[model samples]
Target chain A: MPGTETAYQPTDRTVPTRSRERAAYDRELVHAILDAAYVCHLGFVRDGAPVVLPTLYGRVGERLYVHGSTGSRPLRMAGQADPGLPVCLTVTHVDGLVLARSAFHHSLNYRSVVVHGTAHQVTDADEKRTALDALVDHVVPGRSADSRPANGKELAATAVLRLDLAEVSAKLRTGGPNDEPEDLGLPHWTGVVPVRTAYGAPVPADDMDPSVPLPGYLAAL
Target chain B: MPGTETAYQPTDRTVPTRSRERAAYDRELVHAILDAAYVCHLGFVRDGAPVVLPTLYGRVGERLYVHGSTGSRPLRMAGQADPGLPVCLTVTHVDGLVLARSAFHHSLNYRSVVVHGTAHQVTDADEKRTALDALVDHVVPGRSADSRPANGKELAATAVLRLDLAEVSAKLRTGGPNDEPEDLGLPHWTGVVPVRTAYGAPVPADDMDPSVPLPGYLAAL
Candidate 1:
């Protein structure tokens, strides 16, 4: 199953060699973590300093896409250079809190994916529409078809950037904390404190045209 | 209540003047968003490239604290220079999924704080303990006191970085999507899809010493 491509030495960015086992080099694991996250932190350096922005993102097969206004600085910068903008995109989902017997061993149960790549701005007219659709669909599955497509002016003003799924890694921590054997006898309550995310009932806008019914995809979500 | 000391300026690093109004400068609003968040994205440039990492963080007064092992690159870098490491710290809470009448207007309802500063490593023994306590209390209140304090060896191995909350901004988008007046008459369902976070029942470890009872503070959390 892991014989799809030749393996390369994946650089350890966050966790070093001592914590290497927590890092997963599998593509499926990385993709799953990215797909499940609602938002992503896009990092880019502007004027020799680092800036991180939390934004919505979408994944299409082996490529990830992000969109912003054409006037946006980062979007414009990505299209300027030959290699585009060298960026690191990260998505994380906190699964649970690992409470260990020893304070030093306490940790969190989380699934995260980090992508290191040079993003190129999407310029083609048809491809822009396709990318926008993918972005909309990723946020709300069937709602893209029910809503009006972007007009020519709107499309022209928008900027879409695509980053390939290369140089990526997934790190996951699940189950409870691995407290030391000696600490197991310490009089401290220890376990996994669960964390969860939920969606509330959709509230229709007051100005909504009463004729239109809620879409099935939104209701399902 | 807008005191002179609480005022924040829009620097070149700040999201331009137009985007600045949408960016809140209020301290209370900033603290509310920060305290409610468990994780923050730390962004820094490495070798002319942007790198973003998601990690646990805590806020105490006007200072934000992030900790890591002394061997970590970022931590080591932060400890080197006198002025410290230039970093951008951001914390965001997703409140709702905004569904607009038109697909172009689709966005998220969120509250986020972005702090632009140079992080200084905490070296003093007393300050380190206080910062560590704040970190633990930020996650689980009172748990810091209940657990064993870090020993000299553990303290020496850990690195705590602090960023003052001076050049900070909090941006929030609440309510439903701001669809255009003309689009409001369109036959499309539009509104907000709320998002929520909840805590689940605690799962005690099998090897946990039964003598220690669940602390009231943790139980309340």
Candidate 2:
């Protein structure tokens, strides 16, 4: 029997050892995890301290774009910094809860990606629009075509930062916990506790015009 | 008719201005959101610089606990700090994707908690065990009772920190996007695209003894 072909190459950029089996180097696996997640926890050192902020993000091919108000502290800091701000952007999808025979070993089945880079602020108008469109489409596939584009005032208030997917690592953990042979007979739960996310029936805005129908792209989602 | 009275106060921790009709706030609500999620983005600043890191966390009644190895940079810096580390711990649950008739209004329906406080390290053994149990049970409810308690050696290697619930806020956004009245006739999709989390069938560990039955608590999850 032949073994499966591996898509991810073990390199300096990949975390080949931290979690040997769970870590994946495959590009498709990496992209799937990134694409499925809607928010990214962006970590950066401001002074000598670390701060993490949960924010909206969009991925364009291998590049990731994050937007915020120009007046936001991080945005201002990134724009003014000499070497730009070093940041660790992370996105995670929690698939299930791992129930181990022992509490000490209980874990979660998840997919996560961490990107290390210096993000620079986008200043050009065309680039800004393109990034903004990517952001909107990321949240809603056809949204850029439906809504009015950002006006001058809105554009002036917004700032978009770009970080290429140059140095990144994806870590994953799935399946049951590794229980010791003796501990297995101790009589405890030993399977995945499933976690799920579902959409409830749509609630239209109280002031909705009711003449328009819900879009198919959103309907499919 | 008068509304039902409850013990959990909705005043302080809940947002008064944006009360989510579909959302509920109570101890159960708080615990569920905290337990189902993994990885909290801790935000803090050192020397006027901001930084954030992905770290493991556990939550007890009205308090959230985080731990790191003693050699961890943040732990060392936090131990020496005067007012402890000024930290913001945030956990978010992305419930669904909101598709708006207009691109500008596209948003995500999510439930998130933001906690602001100074984190202090845990030095006492009893408190450490309590916090560790909370962390364990936060991920798996009954397993804490079944597993071997952390021995002295393991406990000695971990550094635990705590943040109270006094300065915490839980914000939630649910349902479809609120499209503008005039934009309704523009023939755009405007409904929620559901996001879901599903679990594959369990794969037992190869080394399991096979004599022990899966516990009811784990099965219930």
Candidate 3:
């Protein structure tokens, strides 16, 4: 298990004003939320305008890595020789929808982590390979070991960028909606509709060999 | 039904260089993706750094509205007297996880829509009310009609911003993973694991009146 003693020191950007009680600085909770979500929205500035792209991400210790084709705009920008790219990467898991008596109180139960920092391109070969493995393992637990590793040409074509988890905060809202005292008597129902991500049976590829059985790790999912 | 005749004109920024075939400019498809996803990552430049926030949003025709507290940074910035905030709003649905024979070929099947434009504060009371209702309905169909509408004080506390759907593009990755020809004989399993956002049974609030019946809209979920 990872150490729980270290907590992220929140910066001005990570601080929450509205519903401040939901904000968490504990590293354990932040790591848990990051680990659970496979995809993250990476925000970056392109020509003074903000651009958000959804992509796969992996976290290792206090560092998070995102890889993409070198030809991609965001990847090329991060790999540039100048100062690193300033990004705010966010991962959110919507747990449920809070149905309140009044429309104003209707909200979502969600856990979200926001990381604000500069991302630098990984130049070291060892770090790049490890990041790639982590990325695969992130989507599927035993995927990296089960599948063939990236070749030299493929590694060269891929760009892996790393961001330190320095300024990060996880905010989550749970339980039922907070309805007004008077609205409780309203005819409408008030409750929490839980939302969950479920995985269906693995569908074999059309060209897959008939003898190949589904892996245990995937079957477990 | 929405007309299928109109299509978004792709600009320099909206054009996709990678997987060009997956890029779509059809307004109908873009709207469908936006409507299906309840939450969107709103991206805006804050103090020269990119900030991406996950928030609830609603769409009406060609405009998308996101509501937040009046004191929130993004809302406040959008309502500023100067030029409106240039924002990128994105909604993504992860349909499935593609497990490929090679780790390098592993990918995801997803549908995502990106809207790039200026977001202006909706000051009109009528529009704000409609947007609020649309937001409630976005999460649960017929919810706005079933629930009590927001009163004056609640409306005062909320701030809604509107973004036009002019600069929009929907990119989707569907079907199975594309593995290398040589990797077809690999022992690893290769397939797509379908993912779905499922809704569990509703949990009534502690203060909910026992006499109140579950709403039909929620029951359908």
What is each predicted model's overall lDDT from 0 to 1? Answer: 0.82, 0.70, 0.92
Worst 10 residues of 3 chain B by lDDT: B1-10
Best-performing candidate as measured by DockQ: 3
lDDT of 1 by residue, B1-221 (tens): 22345556656666543345568777788888999987899998777788888888888788899999898777988988768989999898988989887889888989998899999999888988898888877888777877767888889888999988888888888888887777777777889999977788888887776667877876797
Sort by DockQ, top down from the best = 3, 1, 2
Identify the runs in model 3 with alpha carbons over 4 angstroms from their true place: A1-5, B1-5
Error of 2 at A160 (Å): 1.4
Off by over 4 Å in 1: A1-9, A12-18, B1-4
State in Å the error of residue B213, model 1. 3.5
Candidate 2, residues B31-149, lDDT tens digits: the string is 66777765687766644544455666888766789877676656776788877877878788777777666666677877776666788888888989999887777665666887777
Cα lDDT tens digits, model 3, B1-221, are 33345789899879876878999999888989998988999999988999999999999999999999999999999998367999999999999999999999999999999999999999899999999999999999899999999999999999999998888999999999899999999888898999989999999888888888888888897
Q: Number of clashes in every candidate structure?
A: 0, 16, 0
Docking quality tier of candidate 1?
medium
**Tens digits of lDDT, candidate 3, A23-130:** 999998999999998899999999999999999999888899999999888888987847899999999999999999999999999999999999999999999999
lDDT sort, best first: 3, 1, 2
Q: What CA root-mean-square deviation does each model show from the true structure?
A: 2.6, 6.4, 2.0
